[model samples]
Target: MIVFDLECRRGQHRFEGWFRSSEDFARQEELGLLTCPNCGSADIGKALMAPHVGRKGNQMPVHAPSVPPPAAAPAPTTLPAPAPAAVAAPAVSSTPLPPEAMALMHKLARMQAEALKSSRFVGSSFADDARAMHYGEREAETIHGQTTIEEARELLDEGIAVAPLPFPVVPPEQAN
Candidate 1:
């Protein structure tokens, strides 16, 4: 026996019925044998069955309570934001020399040491001795010593030839 969902046209009522075959159901339907139990209407036809679309994979049909369709969603909105100026930037100092510059300074220091191999060290009297040489009171010779930028500039302004040492020089007194 086969069961089918049947309906009556006069009352639009749905019901289930059993039959020996599809042909038996059709024959009975043709002979006005099917009737709605609730309405007793013989104007009966097979109800359109909802297509049995099986769930794919591990999915199951969710049996949720009926909820009214949400009202038309409000127009999309944007969040308020602070001005770009109000955002705090990362604190970074611009004064530090990069690794490449520091490496170059070290390389230049080595090169300067090599070039000053024959030069003499005059200790802290660099300014006075340099001035004396400029005035022809002392013999001119290659010399290197510690001097401030201001003192070097002063020497240069006085027409004295003074070039900065590219590296710190070891004082003769300090050399053991």
Candidate 2:
């Protein structure tokens, strides 16, 4: 599976999309299957990403200096209180979502829950089951299950309809 950082042209919203290959991504885009989860926009495109090139196998690993560095002076026993502005500022790692976005996410989660109510969990046999239904070997029924990206791509190639859930589903056996 390959993951691409995708952006919605309409809202400039960025999200990750996993595909079996570049061709699979192109096929989905051409078929208008790609959409922005945040804005519901169909104008999705790959966002610029930095390549993750690893070091050559023959390259030697860098080692730290064996000698310890000189010790620094001790910190003061007591420090001045932080300013009110600093205390009010949000942390770099914990940006809060806007109220509207939070509401939309909640609504989406509810919708997914409602849809899953009628769908049966087929576990890891999703591809086989879907193929069986599509080829008339089995009766048609709603099913949701875990399958690899390659399996999903194969199913799509075979004209079997399958889609990823917006939110991950806990398998019934694993659910609390």
Candidate 3:
């Protein structure tokens, strides 16, 4: 399978599309089957990409010129063939997170867990509960729950201090 970096012209969203081959991708695009997964836009095109080529174990590395050749400098008596563009990014080295990154993630998870301990899980009534707290109808207390994006935006626009949690929590009813 070949992966193409595809972009949606409408939303400018970049995503990868896998096809059997380059010809398969072109055929799909011609048939209007290609689409942007983000916005569902059919106006998809290949995004600009860097070249990728493997180097032989015995091949020597090419050194970049420290300085550009002078414009007035005499031309070389014999010019070598033009070299191809830059190589692709290095391959992923490991699947596991680095020590420092793992540590930070653990710290953030701990903080979130601790914060959730004091917060009430109101489930789908998050926006309503938040509004009640803001209006003093309910006592001001820590709360965390699920709400639609539109509801969350409405809460923020109404000057209610509600922020989404970094991680989702299991509701009391669903948890042991």
Candidate 4:
């Protein structure tokens, strides 16, 4: 698999896209499948990125490690207690979104909120819930939750329909 930095011309939003090959990316772009997650724009293209070059096989180490003489241990101070777990803030982009992009984002967020009104938030049990529903072990209904990419792929391999949300969801418990 190869990763490419993609940018949306409409919003100037940058994101990564993974593909089997360069041809795969081109095919997706031609088919209008490539889109910006932030502004839902289809005007996407590869972004400028520095090439990654590896050292030659016969090249020696750039910096050799030096060993120092062992010293006596003399420190035994009281350690500070660990801080409570806290939710991390989302990463802010260095560049601000265009006005049109911001407007579109707001509209998309509102649309997602409306669509999720009747859907259930299953938290981390998303994969299990989806599998159960798929296997007829539970009643099938609209559900949204968290799951690892590997788990999602497994579900898809099992013929269960699943899709990723365009935006991150705030858990009901974490919502004010």
* Model 4 per-residue lDDT tens digits across residues 7-30: 789988777777788898778889
TM-score of each: 0.39, 0.48, 0.50, 0.46
Model 1 lDDT tens row, 94-123: 898999999999899889988778788877
User: Candidate 3, 37: how far from true, in Å?
Assistant: 17
Mind sharing the TM-score for model 4?
A: 0.46
Provide the overall lDDT of each model, using Cα atoms, as 2-decimal numbers: 0.75, 0.83, 0.80, 0.83
Error of 3 at 125 (Å): 0.1
| Candidate 3: stretches off by over 4 Å | 1-94
Lowest lDDT 10-mer window, candidate 3? Answer: 82-91
**Best of the candidates, TM-score:** 3
Give residue 159's error in model 1 in angstroms: 1.2
lDDT ranking, high to low = 2, 4, 3, 1
Q: What is the C-alpha RMSD of each candidate to the true structure, in Å?
A: 37.0, 15.0, 12.7, 19.0
Better of 1 and 3 by TM-score: 3
CA lDDT of 44 in candidate 3?
Answer: 85
Residues 22-139, model 2: lDDT tens digits:
9988898998888777767789898898765678999998898886655685556899753121111123658789999999999999999999999999999999999999999999
